[model samples]
Target: MFAMSNPERPVRLGFVGVGSRGTSMLQTALMLEGVEITAISDIVPERVERAQQLVMESGQPKPKGFTGEEDYKKIADLTNVDAVFTATPWSLHTPVMVATMKAGKYGGTEMPACDGYEEAWELVETAEQTGMHCMLLENYAYMRNVMMVLNMVRHGLFGELTHCETGYQHDVRYATIGDQGELLWRAHERYLHHTGNRYPTHAIGPVSQWIDINRGNKFEYLVSMSSRSLGLNHYVAKNYGADHPNAKRQYKAGDVNCTLIQTANGITVTLYYDSLSPRPVDFIYRIQGTKGIYSGTLDKIYLEDTSPVPHQWEDIEKYVEEYDHPLWKKYGDIAVQTGHGGSDYLCMRDFVEAIRHQAAFPIDVYDAATWSIITKLTEESVLNKSKPVDFPDFTRSKWRERKPLPIVNS
Candidate 1:
């Protein structure tokens, strides 16, 4: 069945930004049957060489490597590469994706596809103008539990979703600061001067899928508030010296940011960004509806009519065997061997399958813009004392006519 959709050979891929995340994704891509890593690009020549070695070790010919700072554009123009996937830093995602789309190749990018309104609109407009799909490879959307919840939602188990609360709640002090107390790129660029949900896509992506954002419904507006900036300072002071520059520096970003959003269809969402705080990872994918609710923190579910006991949360595993998404049901064995609990594998498969079959990507450019623009929107609201900020209609009214994403086994 999967083979029938393809009218051509394997999908040739060019990878930009072969850093840690990019190399990890490249490894995942290598696990697939019909994916060819034809080219690799990174500013660091050593990283490019390492990625090419990984490709060669996979028994394929060594992929051509490009090491110029802006060599991603060259990968976009490569004749052998049919699609380009970038796992560059936040600022580079839009540029690489835009270059790929302009070159008329399929583009796949890591989360928060663009940083601000201008780049968000640019992503939307470029995809529309070039007739190419730029997929936001939001692997979180393909998570097993979330995919099961999505299936349950589609089957009316949730019955008219009313609200959702999700957030990127992981603490990443190590990533933000080097061991020598130097500010990392994330600290320098995102947290040093930004004061809102610097990274919202990880938490919002799956919820957006569940709520059908940018499909039949749109994010209308939001108001955001942030706690005082203290986590990073405290971290630096505790780990380094009390008089360290980082400890004394005033970070514009707060330790915790809370945002409230209303969808055009009347569903409400509560988004949080609490990465600076010292805490374990928690996405809090709490989706509530008239019929039932799911709590990702507890990994439990409750239903008014279907639960064995009234007003009690049942283990989500109870329904997993019956409610598991078809994609997981088909590929669980192999996917579990990869990253992010196999989401990386499934997500890459979706990208390759879409390219091979010339089908619309599951997460298109409009969805990318809608989910990613939250960074800028929340910043605006926080800077203005939690004033309501309207979301730009990236689709420009086309969302009204678009159908919700359909369940796909392939």
Candidate 2:
């Protein structure tokens, strides 16, 4: 184990693609101690300028801004940079991450890590060969509710777990309208037409954390199914088709994708994902065990051994304070003031601390590959009419040889 320290000098960091998500991450990075935003790059000149301006406006020293993809690479290879944060498009994550790892710099990548199995494998291989950290910054896993639920399951509060379900559902169809000849880079109608399970990690990461998946059980196989893309197409036509160039073209309806995962322990998890619904944003997480059942949607829990009254869903922060995950006990308070219910701060903190201390990252390469591959696997199963697909054992029994991640306060 490595001891934490206050670095005499701040660790210099570089960011690629400072857009909506990137800007938020940059804001969080600036709030942390022992970190410096030394450089930033984006394909769009305006975004690069805006990010540099934001940094300057925040009263920090302005970072050097670079435009174009090659410039991003140059920034990544800078000797002064200790780490790189890749918040670019999903397709760009793998290549940028590989380059950052090759440069001997730690990398924090946006979620889903990669779009396919080959890219995911290459990322793991490169990170291992380079001996650098490549963490998939799945912010949802760091949320207070997620950590609390993980604690509950870790302590066997819900004994002998048998099943779980979780998902990310939000509607962004209006953005697809492409008003005033604008192109929608993030529109589901634009990029997700050919993809299945467009977003899976937000729902899967928390559940996997709760079950101690990479540390204990591994995913054995999965089968996926998707509802037709009718919803998305309808929204596009009703809102966008009249003035859009592709008005005559049939818009691909987004899918409500579900994947049934079988764990090595014989437990089953039903993972859900959707982005086309006209509904309130929800990260519905539910777990069932022999002793009790916990449901996040109803904000209620039931214990089979006790009285039948459903425990109203109390604040997760309160639960974290009461039966805290050890990581939370030590760092949770420090992170609570930041965004994403404090997860963004904690994720960055862990990544920076691990790099500074030369300790294993909280989420390792294998964990990232597993979740990244699962997203692809889910899509494959959907294409194959929900056929069962075996999950490759990336660790190949190495997890048994590795020590469990220390529960900081446990």
Question: For residues 1-410, could you state the per-residue lDDT of candidate 2 as single tens digits?
Answer: 11123466677789998988899889888887877888999989999889998888777788988987767678767877788888887778888888888887888898778767789889888887888878888888887667777777767788998999888776665555466434375654233455456667788888887776777788899998877666555565566665555444444434577778999888889887777677887778889888877777865566655534455343334344566666666777767777787899888887777667666777778888888887678767877878999987777777556554544511
Off by over 4 Å in 1: 1-6
lDDT of 1 by residue, 274-385 (tens): 9998899999999999999999999999999989999999988779889999999999999999899999999999998889888889999999999999999999999998
Model 2 segments beyond 4 Å from truth?
Answer: 1-6, 174-177, 180-183, 187-193, 241-248, 251-254, 306-321, 324-337
Q: Residue 328 of candidate 1: its Cα lDDT?
A: 94
Clashing pairs in 2: 229-253, 299-313
lDDT of each: 0.91, 0.75
Provide the lowest-lDDT 10-residue window in model 1: 1-10
